[model samples]
Structure formats: C-alpha cells, structure tokens
Target chain A: MGTGYSIRRVERQDYEGVLQALSALTTVGSVSRTQFEETVDHWNHVKVSSEPEILQYHPYVVLHGEEVAATGMLFIERKLIHGCGLVGHIEDIAVSLHHQGKQLGRALIDHLTNLGLRHCYKVILDCDERNVRFYEKCGYSRAGVEMQRR
Target chain B: MGTGYSIRRVERQDYEGVLQALSALTTVGSVSRTQFEETVDHWNHVKVSSEPEILQYHPYVVLHGEEVAATGMLFIERKLIHGCGLVGHIEDIAVSLHHQGKQLGRALIDHLTNLGLRHCYKVILDCDERNVRFYEKCGYSRAGVEMQRR
Candidate 1:
C-alpha cells in the first residue's frame, strides 16, 4: 500500500503501457495494435458486445510515474447455491520483472482483495506451484486443488 | 441426441421453470416476480451492465414437452499465452431429481462441449470428488487441482 505507484482502472492509452508490463510474464507474445485496442475496448465501461451476466470483469494496472508496473484482472461471480451471494475470481496477475521484489506484487494483490471484499463475499485466485508460498505470505491459505485442460 | 427432448437457449417464460429446476440443486428461496423478470432480462441478450469481451455467456435448458428437464451455463474464454486462442468453462449445471439416472447430465455436458469446440480450443469444468468419475466418463481427464477461497 505504500508503493509510490498508483493503481487504477486501465484506459485506452494504457494499452501499450500494460503490454510493456505484461512482457515480463512468460508465454505471452506480441499483441497486434488492433487486438490491443479491442482488449481495451472490452475492458472499458462502454458496451461493445453483449457478454454474460455472471462475469463482471475489471482490469487494473499500477503506474509508476508514466510506466505500468503491474496488472491484474478480476471477475465478480454470482453464486446460486452458496450462502455467499457474490465472490471474486482473479486471473492474469503480473508484475514487471524489474519490479518483482519491491512489494509491488503484494501491493497489487492486497488492492484487489480489498476491492473484492467491497462487493464479493471473498476473492479467490489460482497460481502455479512456484507462487504458492508468495500467496501464503500474503495471508492466503491453500484450499482445494486446481485442475485445467488445454 | 434423441431423448425426445430439445436443448434451447433460455427465454423469459423459462424463468420460473428454470428456477423450479434450480431449486433441486440447492435451497433457493422463492423469487419475486420482478426479480425473476430481471434475471430473464439479464440472461436474454447480454449487457445489463457493460462486461469484458473474453466471456460469451450462454445458459441453456433441456425441454421435455412443456417441462424443463436440465440446465447449464457455458462461457467462452480467450487465452493470450496458449496457442489455443479460446477455451470454455461450464458452470451451474443441474438436472431435476426425478430425471436422475437418465443420461441427461451427460447429454447436457456433451452439448455444451460441442458448443465450446465451435469457438474454443477446448472445454473445461470443475467437479466435486464424487462427480469426477462422471466427468471422466464424459471424456474429461483429471489434469490439475482446483483451489479456491470463500
């Protein structure tokens, strides 16, 4: 929370800035300008397409002066069965390689968790094996198993 | 495919019918007429509030004559890193208790999987330990673990 960087919702101008931050993450490749614009449009509050109601998607970034330092996406889900009516799912969290150790990732996660608590019963995220301890240090305890395909 | 039942997208009138079916899955209290109408409105076309583009949400139900037999919701997600551009996530699947032991569950999963394949690289769903074998029978294999909080 004490980071010099400011965290805010992503904007059209932040597309390239976010991409620069995303480059530090593994497996992501070059995104065309058009594709990037489309992504920005989707994340923007403006309605371009009719998306399902269950996913209330929000993407945010941390800016240090003019440079993007970290980014994450969050989705609010409505649960039918659980007594908890709303919950959050987080995906695609990344910090610029240069910003790794400065508590930037921790700051970003904390910010998201706070936001989720405002509307969601609780927030959840999935990480690879390497990041388990990192999340545990952030006050998250391991629960269940993660399964995926493709 | 020939169960004398037709799978179709949910419509406004299907609200009560679907809610009746959903009641079997959990303890959902009765919904006011206005709430039911609002839910149908949300599911019918897409945007209630603006949402991101990655997920194309669709909720479907199986109709046997005038009765609703089963239901499921599917989401198509676009992946950035994987060569696979899109994937599907299935949730909120339910079958009427009276309809159990029939292949309705399998039929619904297969139907959604086919829909996912049309636009996604693969389809995925998470199940409780008890239902793991059921999904395995539907051609999904255990690939990883699922973790969550709240």
Candidate 2:
C-alpha cells in the first residue's frame, strides 16, 4: 500500500498505459488505439451481458498516480464436469520494471484471483519457472504442466 | 481408423454421451438433461454468432456407432497481445475406458488442435504427468508450469 497506488478495472483511457505495463511480460507489438478500444468494448459488453458466464473477461490494472503499473486478466471457462462448474484462467499478469519490489504484481494477482474465485470452482495460471516461487507465495501451488503447440 | 468410429461436432442429443465420456476424466456429478441442453444451446449460439471470436466454443465427440466414445472442447480466447491475436485452450479431453488405445483420443486432439490453429496463434493445454507424454506425441511441448488455487 504505497501512497498514490490504486487498483481498478481497466478502462478505455488506460489503453497505452495497460500496454506499457504488459510489455513487462511479453511482446505486445504495435496495437492501434482503435483496435484496443474495439476489443475493450467487446470485452466489456461480454462482461455485462446475459450470455454464458464462460465468455466473461475480467481485466484489471494497478495505477500508481494515474499511471498503469501492473495488469492482469481473468477468463472464466464453462465446463460440463463438476456439475457444470466454472474454471478461471488467469493470464497476462505483469508489473512494469520500475514498479518491481513494490508488490504491485502481487496486488494485481490477488485482485484477479479473488475476482475469479468469486465465480469459479478453481483458478489456474501458467508461468515461467523463475516466477513459480512468486506465484506460490501468492497462495498458488503447482497443479500440472502447461503444454502448447505453437 | 476403426470401423464404426467417427468424430464430429457434438449435438444436443449427445449430452448424456458426452457426460459419460467425461466421467472417465473426472467426476462429472449429476447434471440434469435440461441443464445440459440449455448450456449446449448457449454454446452453439455463441459458436455461430459474430459476437467476438473469444466467445466461440468448439466441442466435439467421437462416436462408436451409436455410442459416444470420446469428447474434447476448444475455447478461443481473444487477446491484446500479438496484435490482438487469438489463443486456444484445449480442455476436457477424455476417452471412455473401453475406447482407449483406439486412437480416438488422439484423433479428437488432432482435430481440435488443427481447428484451433486455423484461427489461433497457439493452442495450449494443461495435463497431468501421466498424460504429458501423450500430448507431447501430439506435437505439444512443455511450455510452462500450471499453478492453481482451488
């Protein structure tokens, strides 16, 4: 809890700030402002719609005095198993280099994890080995191995 | 490649069969027929709608004559990374005990992976240690570690 630090749902105006925060995680490339607005609009619409909960997208950003310092997203997946339960996938979590050691990453992760746990039976994520200890400290444990075909 | 074996999109009528197949993977519990239909209907509607591709769900079942032998689902996730690219999550892949070794599981995985790759930059999944080799044989390499709070 540093002064001037706050966390909230990402808004359209945070487009560039969010991307700057995400660059700490992976290559975000050049995303036009129009494309960002359109995607955020669609995601917001899904978040509030009567559609199946599986389509829900919850994205959050941490602001250090109006600057996006960290970001994370939670996706709810519908499943037939466990009596039609919901599973949450946490993705794209990042904290800007300058913001490291401030616990902003943990804050964003906890915020997203709590939001996901509200409606999900289980919340899961995949991360690099170096980050495993950090996530474990965040109350997550090793569950399985991530496999990919890219 | 066996006679009387076929894989196709799951129909509303395949609800019970799909649940039966899923039980081989984990506890499915008791899901009313009506609940199954309603969820399937919603998923199908999203699958066909122009409402963001992230809402799209592709579920498939392998039929052995009139019986369902296997099932799998692919969820397309919209992302701001990679220039607003798509990522596919393959989930709930299972095969009936009697259907094991028939390559139905492999067939379903391949079908879903190819379907996902057509629109996704990458297809990803999480699996237990026992199933890791099988997925690796299906062209998926270990990408990262799966962490969860359940």
Candidate 3:
C-alpha cells in the first residue's frame, strides 16, 4: 500500500555486513556464528578474487534501503557445448531473514533470469532436494541429475 | 630436447576426470569414487549459481600431457576492503601424485592469480598451516588469524 521494496546488486563493502547478518540469521536456528562465518568467508573468497579473469562473468547485488536483502550470480561459461557453447548459472541466492515473504527472493531471481536472457543463453541452477519447491517457484525445473561427493 | 612442458586452462569435460582424481589426493591418501562423485556434484551446483545478490566462483586446473597436474580457483570479487573486506579465494589446490615436478602447481597458481588481479578488489584463499610454503611460493603472505565457527 505504501512502498514496495526494491531489488539491487550486492557490492564489495557488503561482504562483512552480510557475513555478520548471516551469523545472526543462523542464530535463529542451525549453525553457530563461528561456523556460519567460515561458510561466509568461503563464499566471499569464491566471489571476490585478488586476481581476476572469470571475475567479469560475475555480477553485482541488490540493496533494500541501503541493506543487502538478496543476492545471486549471472554465471556464464565460455567453453563450447551446452547450448551454443555459452551457459549461465543462477548461483547463491540469499534473502535476508527479516525480509522473507516480501517476494524479494522472487524478484531477485527474476532479475537474474532477465540478465541471462540479455546474454542470450540458458540460465541454470541446482538446489538441494529440500529446495526443489522454492526453485520451482522461481521458474527453474529439475534440469538434470546432480550429485555431490562430499 | 623432448617436447617441452606447457601451461593451459582446463577444458570443461576435464572436470569429471579430476573429480575422480581427488580421491588420490585426500589427506588419508584416497577416497571411494562413489563418495568422491557426490561432492563433485555439490561443488558443481555451487560453482554454477549466480543469482541476484550472490557471487559464485569456481576452480581451474593445469594440464600436462592430457592429465591434470595441478588445480586452483580463478577467483573474483567486487569492491572489497583489505584488512576488513574480503574477495575471492583459491581452494583445493592439489598436484597429481605422478606429476609433482615440472612446476605444474606454480604455473596453475600463476595463471589463476593473474585472472583474479584483473577483475576483483582482492584475491584471497585459505589452506592448512602445513600448506604455508605451497601458498607462499605462489606469492600469498600470511598475517591475519582465521577462525571458523563451523
């Protein structure tokens, strides 16, 4: 009725804040802050690099009132095969805990898909069997059989 | 002289092979291919996702005579802080048991590092303290203390 939230790209400075916020998010349930921070750090390194080649393939984040509310990647593959030799990955979609149910997650994913379309290729993402419904809601189908040997 | 050794980026199809090769590099020496394949599937999902607010990074491998000899990530990050902000990471660096010589590891790190320097604000990675020399030789200096809550 009053103001609809906005979706934006995440920036570099948001790393620590997001990590801290995730620590808080997990505090609501599962992991401890220390454990969560490690995951966040691992994610950070994967996203940002001291050297840059594949960096150009990555994209930015979205901010709601100056706070990062959602994030994802517009992943691209330069190698041949898998649809005209170029493909996109829909990666690391996260929504702020307090911001759940606002459709911010949907909007963020839609934005990523549109970006992929702009590049003219397929946009793909894999989810835990637990998240199949959430991704289905986001317009992604069960594309293939993916297994993790961890 | 015989055919001189060389360096190059990994082909996409080469991944599944390396995924299987990881068993030989495990801390305990080897793991079951069945167990190894599962983790590879998981990491594949992680690397392929790049939705709205998140960054997704991946690994690159070095080849010697059609075999993977060394591996690391071609990481990237956005505007990040040095002491505070963090960017990308280079992870899972392993040299094949049979190809330890020929400077394959050094060549792989050099290639991936250059890729990161071009795009992101910083490139960072973590390894067990025992790997200090391995990373140091690759030009990584250790300073900050890293603790994981997980």
Candidate 4:
C-alpha cells in the first residue's frame, strides 16, 4: 500500500533496478553492463519516432519510490498482409515478488495494450497456459496455436 | 532446372518479381507501388548493420531464370533471459505455385536457420499444425504449447 508508485518509460539509471526486478521471473545471470547498455541503446534508437509506431520499442517500468518494482516491453512489428500493417508483440514482463499483489503486472499489460491499440491493428503475445487466464481478463481472448522449436 | 536459379538477398530492383512471388502465398490485394517502395526502404534501413544480427532483417528471394519464384523473411529478436540473447523469427515465406515441388521452401528455411545459428543460440518459428511436419523435417522439433489471444 505504497503511494507515489507510477509507471513510466525506463531510463538509463533504471537499468539495475529493472534487471533486479526481472530476475524474479527467470534465472538472470551475470549480464555485463555493456550488454545492458547495448540493449537499452537499441531500444531507445527504435523508439525515436511516433508516426511509425513499429519503430518504437517501449519498455515500461513500475516505480515505487524510484525502485523498479516491475517491467515489460512492447515491440512493434510491421505485417505485410491481412490488411494489418502494424502489430504489437508483448514480452519480458516481470514483477518483483515483493510487489506481486500490487497489480503492477496488470498495469504494465494495460499500458502496453493501450499503446498497441492506438498504433496497431492487433496486439499479440504468447504465454504459458498458467498465465492465459490473467491475459484473458486483460481483454485478450484465446486465439491460434503457438509452437516453438525444441 | 534453370541454370541461374539461386537464392539471394532481395535487391531494390526485385520489387516486381518479389510481388509476383508473394501473390501466390495469399490474396495480395493491390499493394500500391509506393507501399512496395516504402517496404523495401524500411528493410534496407533495418539491415544497415550485421554485427548485432538482430538489426539485420534478411529478405531473401529465389531467382529462377531472372524471375523471383519464392521469397522469405527472417527477423531477429533479442531475449534477455534463458541465457539466449538473440532469437530468429521466420516469417513471410511464400513460393509461387509453379515453384512448389522444387524444394524452395526448404532452401529458404535452411539459409535463414544457418544464419541464425551463427549469431543466435536458437531459432524459432510458429506455424499451424498443417505446416509443423515441414518444419520438423527442417530440424525443428515440437517443444512447447503456443497459446495466443483470439
């Protein structure tokens, strides 16, 4: 029940906090500072334009008193067919274990989905079955099959 | 068997041929010349570098006697977890009806997968059950469940 918790685009200084928050979602090992910088630099470069929504790779973080409690990324992809020119793919969503019940995950998803709706015909994401109901409650209905390489 | 038939990166001049080949994959409506030009320009901008691999969006076409008979696109994505940094996503694969039995699809898949292996720990693609067997034969085995929004 903390106040002044806001969600915003990640900044350079937020890398460490963001990484710490992401570790709870998976085994985040020793990622070099250079790698982190490179990833953020690439993301910043991609988001330079607003007209071409696909150019913007938005990575948002939930800040509770300047501490990154959660993070998510939305990448825009341009589609060539189906009259769907732009699409949004959501990935890298994670909420720190301590901040789990604060609804930060839902907030991040809503924020990304809102951005997607403004610029893309569809915003899609793939998740494990366990997380399917959560996304369904967020307005995403069951769609097609998802297969991956072994 | 045309002597000049080969697979190569799509050149600016291959627009018309590429369009012709892509039409067979789906009911491609009247895509304006400007749209085609813009797409090629976008692809060119994305592939300005090769070191990162993720920045190089490869669009390849199979040329059969000065005509583009098949086309495919490979887009690289970077992952932050799972010890995997870069992942290759295959998309927009199409072959002209006349070129169906020539194994062009396999050729395109192999070319992209090989490039992926060099810069990425793993390459993955999503396909309907109908096309899973084809990809399995290309060395991609069934792995995880794919669930998406409707």
Candidate 5:
C-alpha cells in the first residue's frame, strides 16, 4: 500500500502516537516493553513540561493519516571552535514496514538534510553497513567504516 | 602548567560540572544555554537514577584531581527492529582547554569503549573534521566522508 505521510516535530499531544509506533514495531530489534514505555513516557513528559527546549533537539515520527510509521532523531547542530568543527548528527532512524516501499524514508531524510543545512550544521550522520543503500539513495554517501566493538 | 587530569563516569551531583563545560563551549557550536542545560540535566538524572544493570550505559568525566576535565557516554546495543537498534551513539562530548595536551581525551574514549563492550553495545560516534585526527588517535578511524546538508 502506498503511504501518505506528513512529518513534523512532535508536540506533547503527539506522545500517544509515538507510543503507538513503538508498540507496533515488533521489527526484529532488541527492545524491552518496560524500557520502551519508559522512554516514550520520558519523551512525552519532556514535551509537556517544556522546561527545557530539549525536545527540539531530537527527531520525531511520521504520521500516515494518524499513524506513526517511522521515527528518527536529529542532534540539533552547533558549530564548534568557530565553525572549524563538526556540528550535528542524525541517528536512531526507523521506518515502518508498510511505508518502506514508499518514498517516506528518503523523504524524512531529505527533510532532515534541508533542516540541517538551514541550521548550518557541519557534520552529519553516516549509516551502518546494512542501511548504506537506503542512505545513499537519500544522497548520503559513506564517510568511512563505522567500526563498533562491544 | 602541567595538565593534571582524571576520568570517571558522571554522577547526578556533577550536574554543575557538565553545565560549566557546556557554557564554556557556547562559541564552539550553535547551542542555547537554557535548552542545553535541560538536556544536560536529563543525562544527569538518567545516569543517577538508571538501574544498576543499565548504569553501565552512562559515561562521565575524569577529574584531574577535582575538576571535570573530560566526559564520555556509554550505550547498550542490539539490532532490534523498531527498538533501540542495539547500537550506541556518543554525542555532546567535550574536553577542557587546560587538559588538551594530555591523553585524557583518549583515555576517556577508551573507557567508554570498554564500557560499551561490557554492555553488549557497539559504540559509535561522529567526529568533526578537525577532531578526526583526535578520534583517530583514540583508535576510532574514519568511517568515510560523513556529509550532512541540513
């Protein structure tokens, strides 16, 4: 099915949508129901309190006619040492299965890229090995081997 | 002056130290004080209140005697679809000017890397163009040309 979507920063009222997406994402990733609910609640509280503009710094989800299909985060950028350093990073990205075949994934990325440029961030994110093609299609070429050891 | 130094995981009480670092870094990048403090506070609280099992996920500064000279973070990784994706990303990092020369930065990074491994998380981070050399020295080689427009 073709996906119809609109994405924007999440407001406090959108917390339920964020929760719903997390609940539906039984997508082979490691997650704890308790922790997921806790994280979602924390995000929602941050939006409601507005004590800190922290909510503005992260990414939100996509609404497919009232459904949360995907989610991502943007590390609100800042130039360091007088623009001689890297600024922002985008991470924690996911698009739901139904919307995967559609262009929403690339679109969300494009939206973030434009947003990053508008804000003038220096460095951006590089995808993991598995998602390289997905990001490449979004014009995100590899920066280098993202080596991780645990 | 010799750059006396130290490194350790962050504590909730060290909230002020992290805030001071963020304040000193105002010109380093585009960041607002109120918004940033809130974000820092969130990290502090999580580190303080996280479950012991999860506490392995937080990294902090190594004080050169009594000051918060450097900082780092740890993550618990997993490849969960629609979950955390089981990877850890290090963000909002900094070092004190007085401690730049010493290998405190490398030590801090290594410490977090070790921590990540312990928690089964694959640690990853993005470095600015200027600090690429710095991270390289820490054993985090370039992944590729990380370019972000927005």
Candidate 6:
C-alpha cells in the first residue's frame, strides 16, 4: 500500500529480478535467461489450457519503484475430497534485505493469500520454526508436521 | 506384498474406493460417480498434454483381490529454482482399517515415493504428529512446520 510499490504476477522480463529476490530465501543457482523464458512460456500455456484448474502455478513479485523487492508463489492443487476443491500451496516467499521493514513481505503475502482464497478452499504453507510466528501473524496456524525426502 | 495385492494408478472405477480410503484422513462428503469420472478424464487429459511437466497429478491405489486397500497421491510441481526442477508433494496416504498392519501402507508409500523420485528432485509431505514415525520409517524426516488457513 506504499507509494511506488506494487505487487503483480511475475513476467518473463522479471526473471533476473525475481531470482534475485528469491535468493534471499534459498540458494538459486545460475539460470539461463532462455531457460527462464521457456519456463514462463510453459506457465502461460498451462494457464490457457482448457484442463481443470489443478496444478495451476502463480508466481508473484512486489516491486518497489523499478526494483523487485519481494516474491512468492502459490500453487493450486485439485483434490478429490471437499467436492474436488482446490487447495493452495504457498511457497518460496522472500523479501530483499534492502527492502525489509517496508511491510512489503506482509503485503505480498496478503495479496497471494487473497488470490488463493478466491480460488481455493484453503491456503497452506510450510515454514521454518523461526518463521512460524511470522506466518501465524499472516493468518495461518500450525496444522501438521512437514516431512521430506531428498 | 501380500498375495492378491497390487499397487497401480487409480482408475475411474476406483472412485468410491478411493474416497473411502481418503475418509480415514478427513471428512469426504458425498461425490457423485459422474463427477469422479469427469475429474479422472481431466487428469488423464493433462497427463497427456505437451506442456512442461509442471502440474502432473498421479493418484495411486493398492488393491487386494479387487478391493482398494490403500491410496496416495503424488503431485509434481515445477519450480523456477533448482534449474526449474520438479518437486513432488505426496498427499492423502490412507489405508483401510481392515487392511492395517499388513505393510500395505508402507508398500503404497514406497511405490508413490519411488514414482516421485524418478521425476522430482525431492518428495515432500505433511502428516499428523502421530503419523510422523510411520512416515519416518518409510524414509521421510521432519523438515519444517506445516501451517494452514481454511
């Protein structure tokens, strides 16, 4: 809600900027511009498909002036339960260190969660224990244990 | 594997059985047989699309003498990071009470996990604290906190 700050779906041109923002969250190794564009094109194609809205991916970025300051992704998954309802999986939220404290992260999360709630029965996410309080403040609560195998 | 027991992709005819298995996880309201068939067709259509393997959904079930004994789902999500790699989300793993203690759950999990690893960089899931040990025994470890808003 700040002046000169806006949140929108990520574009192909925002590849580098989006990756830069995501780097604040985890290691994002070198990605060629072509690869990024291809991935963007893939997302676009799926968005236009007539298939059911299962597996829809929406990656968003917050821009402060002309710089990408925050990024997050929401993946909508269709489930057989709940009358074949959609479930949103929010992931990879990151805010650039330089843009921290501007409430950009909170705004971006609100934007994504709102988008999710519009189309999903529930929005869910996984975060480190240290960030539980942050997400809890974002209107989420501890629901279950996260398990992984790499 | 027990005699007459086998795991494979869920078919349209397995709708009632699949929902019955999922009921052990949560409340699954009544879903019409036609709705289930339509959803199965949509999934099959997406699986055969030329689009990048971003939103592939695979639901599998273990059958014992033609009765669905266990069920699970693996959703592969395409990520911009990790070289645009795929991340597998395993969900709704359930076994009928009559079929419990026969290692059917473990076998179904292994089958789904193996399918995930073949196409994804990592496989992730969420389970209740009571089920942590079970998933751990199936080769998963606690990774993060699961948060949700319904």
Per-residue lDDT for B2-101 in model 3, tens only?
1545555444456545653443554323434443443334334444223333434456666656766666554443321232232454544667676676
In candidate 5, how many clashes are counted?
Answer: 34
- Once fitted onto the true fold, the runs of candidate 1 whose alpha carbons sit more than 4 angstroms away are A46-55, A78-85, A129-133, A136-149, B47-55, B77-86
User: After superposition, which runs of candidate 2 have C-alpha atoms over 4 Å from their true positions?
Assistant: A47-55, B47-55
Chain A TM-score vs. truth, each candidate: 0.84, 0.92, 0.66, 0.90, 0.65, 0.92
Among residues 3 or more apart in sequence or in different chains, the pairs in candidate 2 whose N, CA or C atoms overlap within 3 Å are none
Error of 3 at B57 (Å): 11
Q: Highest lDDT: which candidate?
A: 2
lDDT of 6 by residue, A1-150 (tens): 689998887889998798898888887877889878876766655541245343377888898887999998887777788887778999989999888888887897788899889878899999899989988899999999999999
Of candidates 6 and 4, the better by DockQ: 6
lDDT of 5 by residue, B59-146 (tens): 5777877787766565332232444444565655676666666776677777777666555535677665677776766667655445
Write the residue-wise lDDT of candidate 5 on A21-53 in tens digits: 544444444556665555545444332124223
Question: What docking class should model 6 receive?
Answer: medium
User: What shift in Å separates residue B77 of candidate 1 from its native position after superposition?
Assistant: 4.1
Which tens-of-lDDT digit does each residue in A46-127 have in candidate 1?
A: 2222433233667789888878889887766554434325666677788888677778888888887777777776677767
Q: What docking grade does candidate 2 earn?
A: high
User: DockQ, per-model, please?
Assistant: 0.33, 0.83, 0.04, 0.42, 0.30, 0.78
lDDT of 4 at B59: 83
Please provide TM-scores, in order, for all candidate models, with all chains considered together: 0.81, 0.94, 0.42, 0.86, 0.57, 0.93
- Provide the overall lDDT of each model, using Cα atoms, as 2-decimal numbers: 0.68, 0.86, 0.50, 0.74, 0.55, 0.83
lDDT of candidate 2 over B8-108, digit per residue (tens): 88888998799989999999987999878876876676531264334478888999998999999998888899888789999999999889999988899
Point to the candidate with the largest TM-score.
2
